[model samples]
Every structure is written in structure tokens, then in C-alpha cells.
Target: MASVNEESVRKIIQYVGGKNNIKAGTHCVTRLRLVLDDESKVDKENLDKVDLVKGFFSANGQFQVVIGQGTVDKVYDVFIRLTGLGEATKQEVKDVAAEKGNWLQRGIKVLADIFIPILPAIVTAGLLMGINNILANPGIFFKNQSIVQVYPQWDGFANIIFVIANAAFTFLPVLIGWSAVRRFGGSPLLGIVLGLILVHPDLQNAYGLAQARSEGTVPVWNLFGLEVEKVGYQGQVLPVLFASYVLAKIDVFLRRHVPDNFQLLVVGPVALLVTGFLAFLFIGPVTMILANWITEGLVGLFDIAPIIGGAVYGFLYSILVITGMHHLFLAVDLQLIGSTNSTFLWPILALCNIAQGTAAFAIFFVARQAKMKGLALTSSISAWLGVTEPAIFGVNLRYRYPFFASIISAGIGGAFISVLGVKATSIGIGGLPGILSIIPQYWGAFAIGMAIVLVLPFLLTWVFSKFSKKKTEAELQ
Candidate 1:
């Protein structure tokens, strides 16, 4: 551990162009989000060579360094100290990175913590609903009334899993917020409380989103005739989070100051009410507006020239998914669900991602080295299921050819899907399975787009890899 601190941390910072080059940083379960001032200054090849840096991305003005979870905080700490960020101010105290607890081990731990625990919730709901669609409509799966009766076709036990799945994704902000608070030196439970308030069923029902839309502002309740308007907060990351962060700091400060005799009564209640109210009124709305603005901008782009824009979007989209920047697009799903009960982005994204995976799969089939082939196979399988970090970071980024092939293939697929004007009927899963999201209506067109994404890239990559291998053999001969 001491050796890792002295050696890896310094080398990583130097290779990434020193701490001065870093613009900002935020850690996720397996990576560090860095914004670099001059990306050109960093030696990507050298950085990749580092055992600690698993992968990285430099695009759209964001530079990300993938160091898994254990190293994230150490890297974050080194980053903050070097960058002089997260300082305690009069109104806000910056949260420092918590103690390191085995990065590689914790990186997997965090992934398991986020994914393994929640995957059954996602897969069960998705598969059941998808199967139900095939069965109830009669033809895809045996056309049996008993089957429909057992599963109930529409209102059966499947909904329980579906609820878990949809709820997990829909209110993912709370999960992230809870983790963020835990990372940021606050009570994870308190952050969950703040997140729940925003996403809670009671709060949602009391807020009366239907009335709010009709009246342009629904009254949450007439608090001293203040008329608190309910605003939607599902899947929102910033508002309640920011409010909680502020409250946590405030709570800490109050703990330091308020008289011991009356601290519990005055500070506790005031902190809760003040933070909760401010969260809904100020923090929630402001961040929601910002999130909305980002969504509107992206949606507007698609509406303008889906083909060209989608091509650009598809190319970057693959990179975004790999780097975790795709969360920005998830915000659009929230708005789409509210407006049309459908999200148009996922199908396009799914196809592009599948195309990249297909390319990786092709590479897996063709690569000469046993090591490369194994890496390609592992990553390709992961990509097939929609997790592209391994494919992109492990194989494509290192090999060079597959990487460019993926980008090109994604661009072609994106352009084709955009021109088709395909869209998803509802917010559902993504990756190959997400093709179902476009079912019953645009299935044919969606299939065409999906075919293009899945087939073209796979065939192209096979040809490219085969040609490269022949050239290499010829050179050796």
C-alpha cells in the first residue's frame, strides 16, 4: 500500500500532465472523472501503460481516468490537494475523499455492490415483460392460455419484478446520491432520506404532478399560505444532493456550535425542515431546470437533423457509455417519459453500442495472440450485454484498429437509425435486449436499424481483421 502511494500516485499524476492540468474531478465506483485543461499535454499511451490506470477517455472537454474504486479516493485526494479544491468555506465545506480500502478489491466490490445486487431486479422484470409481450399477443411463445394464465399475461406476478426494475432505474439518483453522500463525509442514510423525499410515492402523490402540469404549479400544501409548488424530482442528481450536502455541512457546523443542552431540539428540527424545504424549493428546482435544459438541447438536436446529429451522437455515444458520460442522456429519458411515455434515444444508443460490441466480437474471433483473443472475447461478451468498458478499455483502445472500426461502425449505424426516425415506446432496458422497447409499432424499422448495427460492423470488422492478419503474415514471410 505504501509502495503504491509513493510510486503509482505520483507517476499517474505526472503521466496525466500533472495536477495543474486537471480542471475538475469526481469519482464513481470504478473511475475518476477529470476535466483537463489541455488534453494534449497528457501522454495517453504512457498513462495507459500505468498498471493503475485501467482506461481513460478524452472527449467533449472531459478527461476521465479509470482507476477502479479503491484508488478513486486516493487519486481523488491527490487530485484535490494538487488542485486545491473541496475547501471549507463560510457557507459550504468541501467534502474530502474517504479512506482507501483496497482499490482493485473495492472496485469490483463497488461494481458488485451496484450491479450484482440490482441486476436480478433488472433482468427479471425485463425478461418477464418481454416474454409477456410475446405470449399475450399470441404467436411468439406457444400461444397457450395456460401460459398467459400462469403468468397472467398482463397483471401477474411479473409486475413485481418489473416494478423493482423500473423503480431501480427511475430513481437511480437516490442510489447515486446515497453513495455520493457516503463518499462525501455525510450519513448515507440521511442522503437516502433526501433522495427518497424527492422520489417518494407519498411526496409524488401529494405534489400532484398532474395538477402541477394543468395549473402550471401544483400546490404541495399551503404552508402558511406560501403555496409550495410540487416539482418532479425522479432520477434527478443535483438538487436534493446539493441540498443534502449543504445540510450535512450545516449539521456538522451546528454540532460544533449550538449549546449542548438545546442542540437536539433546535438544531435537529431546524436542520431537517430548512434543508428539506430549501431542497424542494431552491436546490431541486434549479438543478432540475439545468438537467431539463441539457435534455432539451439534446432532444432539439435530434429533431433538427437526426441523421447527421445522430451520427455524431452515435460516435460519441459509444465513448460516453464506455466512460460513463452517458448519464447526461439518461436525463432526457426522464423528460421523454413525462411527455410521450417513450424515450427515442435508447434504441439508437443500443444499436450503436451493439455495433461496437459486434466489432469487438469479430476481433475476438480473428486476433492471433492468445492474450489478445482472450481479452477480446471477455470484453466482447461484456459489450454484447451493454457493458463496453472492458471492450473499449481492454481491447479496442489498446489494439487501435478495432477502436477506429467501432467509431466508424457506430457512426454509420447512428446515421441509419436517425434517418429511419425510429423511437422506443417506453423507458426500458438498453443493449441488445432493449430492442424490445421498440416493439409492436416500429418493430420492422427498428429491426432494420438493429440489423445494420449488429451485422454491418461484425462483417466489416471480420474483413478488416482478416486483412490485417494476412498483411502481418506476409511481412513475417
Candidate 2:
């Protein structure tokens, strides 16, 4: 790694009440995530003036100083070396930081940590799925004929596209299991094997079982005369998560009890067999039912009254972001996609991203300070790209009006889209690019919702700022 000014970083320790106050510390791509003995001890004013400091915020019990891209790692190295604190991973720091947070906060942070790393694969597949939809769905290209229907030659091409796009969803358990188990401190490779067992080809497909079981025609294994259903998890989330957790715990427990000399031969196979049997026998069936209930409940909730549901979720989304609880919704979005083949909730989430982006964009035009303007512009662009924390915490929350304006605009926009019955094919990028994830037929509705969120937030925030110049100034100080 590169190095930064040692003195500048040392000054940070002084400003935050010396090295003793830091319980744990780590860095991500752009920020120093620190668990502190006392946040009040931080010299907020002087610390903000430190070299390479972009901004600072306390979230999920970590006093995070935004040190900007390509620079934070450098600063973090100096921080660890100067403070005599051993370097730690972001997860370790987060675990230490959990002491200061409630269970909800800690849980949200853990989920975010696990999912964020695996998002690239899901997002890429989603974007491709959208393209496949545009090509395969009728009415967009021809009045009554899809691209594949009219040009039969394109059938094989569309099939290949479908295969590629469907692979991620079909094997979602593998991704979730690997990531979740690793996060839970188990061997990741073992997680992959466990995932394979959950989705084994010998088992009846989970999606097929739902209909077959309803008709009492589902297959069973009859292992040891216990008569276990031979259903694969496929795209299921909760089951894989539970199974992975059990796997991790079992691995840790056995490692402590087993001899080190026989560890290599004993651990992997024993853990896999025990976990697989337990999962199919108890954990998988129970969690699968639970997962089904949650999926149906959320989908049914929206189906019963989509406009109200959309409006409620939209309005509260940014507030959840502020409280660090929004990460919990990611599982909901994923489960909906797995069960229903699409998610109505994500379209509204995309619009919410637009609202935050546009709200921050408004500040660029309204603010005078070059520093604030720069942050407003950059963070707004970031929000549009689906990372809204910067815009929310850096610009909108600071101005106050922008944050409130965004939720209101998002609520209205979400209601409109819900009325239009917009849905996403998969989890794609959020904000403007997120429109690509919408079902081809609902494109127009999503566009209109996008317009509503894009225009309203900026207009509302600007108007709010105009009426309260003194409040804005006082808050800025």
C-alpha cells in the first residue's frame, strides 16, 4: 500500500482524544471505520480540517471519517502504525463496533457486509436478464410478436441469453451460502459444497415442489425410513443462510473437540455430512417453510394494497438508510425475485435512489460554498449510481430539507409506479440505470416514476431552502 503524511494521521488520533480512545479501527475503500471509546471526545472541527478528510459521520456505532478514494487505505495504515493498534479487517472492526450498536444495527451491518461483496455477479446477471426480456417479450418490438417469435432464428440466441441470465437465480443458494458462511467464520469452500448439496440434481426442484407438494405428488428420499422430502433449495435464501450458520457453528465446535493431528482428514467430510443431513432433515424444511411464508407475506402485502405499501416503503426508505436498517430489505428484494420471478419493491427502491440523487443535485445549485457544492455534485451522482449513503449523509442530511424532500417525492413516485404495476426482472443497478431492470412492459411506468422522483426532489429541496436561508446557514455552521 501507499503512504500518507504520518503527522497528518497522528493529528487525527490527537483530535479523537488520542490512540487510547480507539477501541478498534479499519478501513474500507474510502473511509476509516473506527470504534471509539467516546465519540464526544472527537474534536469535530479540527478533525474535519485534517489532511485528506472529506467528511465524517457516526453510523452503526462506528465513527467513520470519509478519507476519499485512493487515500483512505494510506491514512488507515498510518493510523494503525502510529496508534500501535494491530491492523484488522473491516469485519473485525465491525464486530468490535457492534458493542456500541443494538442488535438490529449489528444484524443490518452483518447482512450488508455479506451481500455487498456478492452484488457484482447478481447485478450483471440482472442487467442481462433485462436485455433478454426486451428481446423475448412481445409488444415492444412488434405489436403482437416478440423478437424470438417473429424471427424464429433468434430462438436459440434468446435461449442462450435466458440460460446465462437464469444461472445466477437458479444457483443463488451457492452464492449466499458461500458469502454467509465465510462471514460467520466457516470455511468458504465447505459452504460451497453445502450449497451444492442443497441444490443437488438428485433432489426434486424447489420451484417444482411447490406445485407438486400442493397436489401431493412431490418426491421423497425415504432415507433410513425417515421419509425426507427430496426438495432442492435452488434460489432459496433463508434455508441456505440457516444451513450455512449451522455449518459454521458445527465446524467450530468439532474443531475444538477433535485432535489437531487428525483435523485435516476429519473436519471437512464430517462437517459436510452432519450439516447436509441436519439441513435436509430439519433446518432446510423448517426454514424453507419460513422463507415461503415471508415471501408470500411480503408479496401478498403489496398485492393487497400496492399503492399504500409502495408509498409507505418509499417514504421510509431513506429514513431507514439514516438509521442503517435499510440493508435488511435486500433479503426481501432477493426473496421476492426468487419466489415471484420479479420484485415490485425494487422499482420503488430505484425511484427512492433517484429522489436522494436529485435532492442532493438541488444543493449544488442552491449552495454557495465550493466544498459543499463539490460534495453535492459528486454525492448526487453517486446516489444516481445506487450508492446513496454519500448523498444522504454528506449533503442531504446536513441541509435537512433535501432529505425530507426526497422521501416525500419518493413516496409520491412510488405510489404512481405501484398504480402502474411496475416490476423488476432482477436486482440491477439503482436510480437511472435501474430502469434497465424493469420488465419491458412496465418501462413507461418506471420512466414516469423516474421523472417524478428526479424532478420533484430537486424542486422541493430548492423551495424549502429558499424559505429557510437562516436555518440552512445556522445548520451549516
Candidate 3:
């Protein structure tokens, strides 16, 4: 990719139907945003295989090719030269794309806007937790032993890593509160304060409430003759999101109505006091009940019919990624991990990723085109490493059969793993190395699930490709 040159640019042009198919062209920080006259004319199989081309996806009406940040501009320069297409601004492309999404897609994009900013924190914590899981757990690293179990002296080191990673999960509500409120144009500092109150030390720890309740030690604040349980909202998602929405509205209304001279005095303190009081007295209790209902409903469904649950989720997860609805699940996954110490959904996500990657891998052996073969191989490897966009948009979805083969394979594997009760200790990388994040005892079950995904995608894709008349005719041509 570092050595990408004019030849690479020309190759990209060739893959996108020799530039004539392009209606408008532009570059973003990391993507080539092109509106194509006829989207199907672009050769997706070859596009991803183009030197330095990372991935491509058709969103709204734009066929966007992701070609890394530093490299994309260079590629776009050559693209402009070779195609003789008039340059379009990135915003022009966005406006065009923006005009095309449905209400659901637009809604999910808003969720994406809220979650994407916080991803680095969550992803880092998830990865660190995976490393710490290996170090702290028995039966993972050294044949039924942990680093602490053997060294004993290194216990603090492992515990320290856990402490670091667990901090993120423990205060997940705060992170969401800040991000969500900011997205809604509220004071982010106030969001942080509101979030802090949800996890205040005076309240009974949310996770420890059951034990505290059993011991009759749960704290309560008595107001007149009434009593309110002093319960904290640790890693709860819905409560924070709902409360943040209310906070944003309150801040906006106060700003509009309050007099400028007294606004500083009235707005900040009033907003803080009202939002905090309402969040604690009403919003907290209501949303916490609603959130628990949702959490328990999902848990009950999966527990009652894990195989059916897994199969349905696995089949749709990659599709969710395409629609960008998957961001919503990150919040849910964190909530589950916080409340239950594990999530059943993330393991299925890993399997779906593997299925997508392996499906693209099957294209390597089946295709005759050097470009398609190369792209398939690279994207597949990228998918195995946890980034599935390349394999999905670059190779599998382009080939149609490979994409279908993958999801079906994922469905099968998901059912198997779910039936076996495979679960993740924390959200982490979502492919082969994802095994490192699995609860150690479920490692064998996950492996068996992987075998199903690996073998099925390859076999199914190979068979399906045999019937691909278009690819076959293209190869013969």
C-alpha cells in the first residue's frame, strides 16, 4: 500500500467500470466517494483487489471505496486524471447520499454518530480485558493454570490490568451520557455530572444490590413518610440514554427561556438540580425498570431457545453491519457484561465475522481473475483479523453467492455455539483471535463452532460459485 502508484489508480478506475460509469467523484478523509450511473457495472471483485484499496460499500447512492487516509488522496488525484471526471466535494457526495436513506437508516446513522466517538475507549478496554483474561484465568495459558496461579507474585499485575479495563465498563453509563448528550447538543460537562450522580457512592452499588438486598443492607433515603431505595445505575445503558435525552431537552429549554442577566445563576444550577433530582427520583427508577425488562427479556429469549436465538442473530448480524445498526448492540453488550459478567451475543458476532472472512477466502480458490483472487485473499485475512468490511463489501457481497453462503454458514455455527453455551468474557476482536476473549471453559465449544463456519462457507460458496453464470461468462470473455 505504501508503494501504491499510478498503475494502482488505473487499476481502481478499471474495476469501477473504466470511469465512464462514474457520474460524480470525490474524496473524503479516507474514502473515494463516487456516484456511479449504473452501480452494478463496477467490478466489485477487482475493486477490493486494487493495490491499496481497503474496501468498498454502496451507501444511499454512492459507491464508496475505502483507500486509507494518506493513500486515498493520491488515488483520487490519479483517478481524476485517468477518468477526466470533474471533481466533486466530499460534502456534495454526502448530500447526495443523505437524500437517499430511509427513516430507519437515518435513525441508525444518528446512533452511529453517538457511539463511534466512544469506540476507541470501549475497544481499548475490551482488548485489554482480553489480555487480562488470559493472565488472570486458570486453564487458558499454561494447561489448566493462570499466570497468578503459577507465579503468585504477579497477581497484582494481572489485577491492575483488570482494574484498568474494568473501569471503562464500570462507568459505561457516564461515557454514554457524555456522548449522547453531546450528540443532542447539550452541555457535555453537565452530562458528565449527571452520569456521576447515577453512580454516586452513597447509593448501593447496582451490581451488588441483590446481595445487599438479601442482607437487608440496601440503603434508602427517607423523604417525609415515603422511602426511596438509594440504588446506583452503574453500567446501565437505557437509563443513561433516556436521562441524557431529558437533560439535553431541559438544558435547551432553560437556555431559551431564562433571562440573560440571571441565566448564568439560574440555568446551570437549576438545570443541574432539576435534571439530577428528576433522574434520581423518577427517570432512574422508570428507565432502570424498562432497561431491566429489556435485558431480562433478551436473556430469557436466548436462554429459552439459544439455538434459534443464535441462528437468527448470526444470520442478520452482518446485514446489521451493512445497515450500520450494529452500533446499538455495543451499548447492550456492555450492559450485559456489567450485569452478568459475560455476553452471549459477542461470541456469535465473532463467528459471523469468521464466516464472512472464510466466505471471501473461498472465492480465492474459485475465481480465475488475478485481481479478484488477490482481493479475496487479502480481504479474507483482514476479516480474520476482526475487520470484516473489506471481506464483506470488497469480496463476498460482490460475489452474491459468497455473501449468502457466509450468512447461512454463520446461522448454522451460531446455533451450534449458542446450544453449547459459548459466551464472551468481554467484547473484543471479532474473528479468529476472538477465541482469546471467550470464557476459557467455552473455548472448545467455540472451536467447534469455528469449524462449522470455516468448512460450511467454503463448501457452500464453492458450490454456489459453480452456478454463477455472470462470473463464468466474464472469465471466459
- Each candidate's TM vs. the true structure? 0.65, 0.93, 0.85
TM-score of 1: 0.65
Candidate 3 residues 173-218, lDDT tens each?
7888888888788889888888888998888999998799899998
Clash number for each model: 1, 0, 0
C-alpha lDDT values of all predictions:
0.62, 0.87, 0.83
- At residue 269, give the lDDT of candidate 1: 70
- Judge candidate 1 against the unseen true structure and give its global Cα lDDT, from 0 to 1: 0.62
The better-scoring model by TM-score among 1 and 2 is 2
Q: Which residue pairs clash in candidate 3?
A: none
Model 1 misplacement above 4 A: 1-154, 169-173, 200-212, 215-217, 223-225, 235-238, 255-268, 321-324, 330-340, 421-430, 436-443, 463-477
- Stretch of 10 with least lDDT, candidate 3: 468-477
Over 28-68, each residue of candidate 1 has an lDDT whose tens digit, in order, gives 66566666667789887677657767567653334667665
- Stronger candidate by TM-score (1 vs 3): 3
Candidate 2 vs. truth: CA RMSD?
2.4
Q: Per-residue lDDT tens digits of candidate 2, residues 99-165?
A: 7787778788889977887889899998888888888999997998899999999899988988998
The predicted structure with the larger lDDT, 1 or 3, is 3
